[model samples]
Target: MEYGEAQQEDESTTKAAYNPTEEDIIEYARFLGILEEEDAKLLFIAREGIAAPLPPEWKPCQDEDGEIFYFNFSTGESSWDHPSDSYFRTRLVR
Candidate 1:
């Protein structure tokens, strides 16, 4: 198996499931600096369908619709929404 596939299999076996709390989502919003504290709550709710506590191998990606999103490694979910314009700005910087 390729290194990436091997690593994924190892992680799938070893990692515990994660469910992100409102507070956790808010904290991530603050870290991204995309929304104000008050707005973070709404963002959390709106994105809850796609949200998971960020996993160790979380990475940013763009969807087919051209919307930026996050991929959670642990849960194998691709529901994380783009938090803010700042997130895209930061990614561009990188």
Candidate 2:
């Protein structure tokens, strides 16, 4: 069987199964305008069986333009520039 077909079959045999294609995830991320293309791609890769977990000090944050980035508190760095002096923030904030 093709790799995708096998994956779908395996997923179907499990409860609460919902396997999303890479393209689908990327498109959805783009639609939400929450993640920059590269960030979205990295996220997709991370979700797809990357051996290591994302850095513990890294958090998902968004810019004023609604583009998502990874903010590393330990390093005081981000995947993209954010407003100075502002805490790393996400849309989930109330």
Candidate 3:
């Protein structure tokens, strides 16, 4: 099988026998090397069920392609990536 197909099969098998926790997901993301450790944790907080809030001025938007982006009301600035992602990461770590 191709690498992507093999990975999908392995992940399915792992999920079939196990209920993964937030930390487990984080660790698995780290193992995949898709994101740095800190980034993975922040991603969980941002997209999973975490209750953290972004700064009031920043709003999240999605393009037609369904990718998320951020816009700052105060500065009228926009970015494809979250502008305060680093700040959120620090807050989550503390």
Candidate 4:
């Protein structure tokens, strides 16, 4: 398996699936009262896999979105950045 990809047991659908639809993304942002576009963009990228794991120094969150604790991918010079179940729920599935 490719690094960062998941195995059968990692399926989020079968698991606690946190796949956020476009609507969900918007709602989540509002729910958290995060109005900054950059933060929203980061969250959006995160929803689409442009996001990455929080830095080693960062602590893991108990939620699936993990946006609450998500560290910025880049401050001024960085760029770039899983789960699922039945019917090929990729990203989370493997």
Error of 2 at 3 (Å): 41
Residue-level lDDT tens digits of model 1 in 1-94: 1123222223232225446666666666555553654553446433442243334665555545554455555666554453343433343221
Q: For residues 1-94, write the lDDT of model 2, one tens digit per residue.
A: 1121111112223313446666655554444343654464345432332222245665545455555455665776655432321222232122
Give model 3's TM-score versus the native structure: 0.41
- Considering every candidate listed, which one attains the maximal TM-score? 3
TM-score of every candidate relative to the true structure: 0.32, 0.35, 0.41, 0.25
Q: In model 2, where do residues sit more than 4 Å from their true spots?
A: 1-20, 24-53, 80-94
The lDDT values for all models are: 0.45, 0.40, 0.48, 0.33
Query: How large an RMSD does model 4 have?
Result: 14.0
Clashes of 4: 6
| Clash pairs (backbone) in predicted model 1 | none
lDDT of residue 68 for candidate 1: 42
Which residue runs does candidate 4 get wrong by more than 4 Å? 1-18, 36-42, 45-94
Candidate 3 vs candidate 4: the lDDT winner is 3
lDDT of each residue in 1-94, candidate 3, tens digit only:
1121111122234335656566665654444333654465455544432233446776655555555556666776766544654543455552
Q: lDDT tens digits, residues 31-80, model 4?
A: 44445464544444334332233343322222343222222223322111
Instruction: Return whichever of 1 and 4 wins on TM-score.
Output: 1
